[model samples]
Target: MKYLLLLLPVFLFAKFASNESCKSCHPIIYEEFQKARHSHASLFKDPIHKAAWLISPDYKKKKYTCAKCHTPTDEKLLASFDYKQTIMPDINSTAQKDGVACAYCHRIKSIENNETQNINIISKKEHVYFGNLKDTIKNPFHKTANNKRFQNGNVCIGCHSHYRNKYGTNICSTNEHNELDSANCVSCHMPKVAGTPSNMKKRKQHAYHGFAGIHNDITMLSRYISVEILRGIDRFFIAINNLSPHALTLHPMRVMQLQVSVIRDKNVTNFKSKNFVRILGVDNNMTTPWKAKEIVKNTSIKGNEKRVSTYMYKLKKGDIVNIRIGYYLLSKKVAKSLGLQNNKKVNRFILLKQKVFIIKPNSFAPLQQ
Candidate 1:
């Protein structure tokens, strides 16, 4: 009878609980979250691993660690607190993507209740959000009953500061092994930097969701006019090479690659990945990536010429074409290194070029080259 009672409510939340509950009013935050590093697409897609099989009978205990560090919120989703595996299919599936989500934070009872207790106490806030998980926008009907916990740093400390019990235990003094840190994770990730908002009195905006790491700068830029495309009578071209050496430094551990394509009758995509260039290096290498379009046509650099590559295309009329430039960065260990994980500025690059056309529309049409 006792076991039956516990099973009853577990079934209820499973039926009704969702992350969309909080996304209702947080549309922009929700959309940016989909592309965040915590997303499964980035964590699970990684190449490094400790032991894939033979360690534990459960795959969740092994392969799912990536999700924990990348998207973990509650213990059920994580395998172990020390390594990345502390994750479950259900919780990891949602909580990880939310990244200090509304439900995860709103559920906090005290600053001390962050991630220490296994207990999930749900006290709603008046204007607060809930865990809907379905829609990206927050629902007014789902306002959390207001609580004092929301007024302070306790909200951010809960998940950011945790204990690594699977390995051993330690006094709160130690911050290693992913447990509680000497300074809370927010001390660095969301540093208390001052920013002057418009005409308002200089107010602190907590640290903001930017987190200020990896390709974060680039990610924020994508929300606006990051890419500009112009299709000509012959070849389709894009002028989105905004990475400038002078802009900011690029993260070392990050591998930035750009892909360019052109097709006949939108055939650009049908064909193979036309041409690509990968600019993977430290901040010092940032300035080297920029080169004028004229440099590519040069036969050879006799003396001290920094040679760069290009993706050139020649298209004709009535030909469908597609051009895509995608950018992705590494987090976790990568960000953890170079002190970037803590938050530092990296270098960036800027490029300029013209899409060349081999033939005129009236003169002749080229198949593809």
Candidate 2:
């Protein structure tokens, strides 16, 4: 059977290229890449990236340089952040338990921008592997190739398109207008579902290595976000459409809520919530990220942006409203000042999209369920 699946990773790890050697031939993309967050992009299983790199500022000079994209297959933690080593890389290492492994994103092969982020060249050719399949099936255990930046998402722009911080300003960014025709990031976070991405190939689907987002399949990224409600006559907007290409929160300790309510005749009334953040500071208050330097405030919501929240409430006739749109991978006051307020999956609340409508006679029907 394909030479016993190529002697099973050369008899288990004589090195077929670890991630437990692609779990014996990609066991359904290694069980959807172990419920991805890039398999808990490391610093020891990403508890909010190890509580923001243990109060970063390059954490006491042991400079783990965010392990070149969080432990990229730990070459002794990227050579202890390239020779500035003061002895650190072994949180039971296998690249700190395979953080962004699976052959370091199939041996990338390009991207080097730089100014403090964006640099994942990788491919020194050892046992090859890069893919956006155009009939990928030739693997005694490795060599694949194809790669048009994994079919145009620029392979996630070498670590999600941006980050600046050492006084160049812009502390976070998911492609803010360097737009090279944005929107693709692997067809919206690796979606293609169903199965068969190698048990040695039979194929009927594939592509979904569980990278969804907002930490885990978020209803398959709520189909890139949407939630309209218009109705005015005394005020009532709520639009919000961001069909995703970036910005809806790409970490600055994320937050995106939009709630809204109004039931009537059964009484519910709740409307005073409309958050969407992007704060960072040094003088206008709110700091962290090694004592920030800019972005003192930003309501965030861009990238095919639509954003409209107006709500002055008023829609009788059958009321019911209720439009939720959530997110928060850390804002409960930044998870109680980073103690992570009991980390229930990093401070709960994730929803993404919701709707109920029904206020007809001026138009608004969709509550039928």
Clash statistics: count for each candidate: 53, 0
lDDT of 1 by residue, 1-369 (tens): 999998885554342234465355444444444544333222333222212211223453454543333443434444354556543445344453454444554455554343332223444343354222222333335443444444333344443333323323211212223233223333333444344211122333324445534434333333222334444453444444333211111222233333455545434444343222222223323211111111111121111222233334445554443434333343334444323444333223222222333334553322221
- Tell me the TM-score of each prediction against the true structure: 0.35, 0.35
lDDT of 2 by residue, 150-202 (tens): 76756777777777777766667886445743457777678788878887778
Off by over 4 Å in 2: 1-56, 59-62, 74-77, 81-83, 86-99, 104-139, 142-192, 203-207, 214-219, 223-252, 259-273, 276-285, 289-314, 318-351, 354-356, 360-369
Q: lDDT per model, in order?
A: 0.36, 0.76
Q: TM-score of predicted model 1?
A: 0.35
Stretch of 10 with least lDDT, candidate 1: 287-296
Q: What clash count does candidate 2 reach?
A: 0
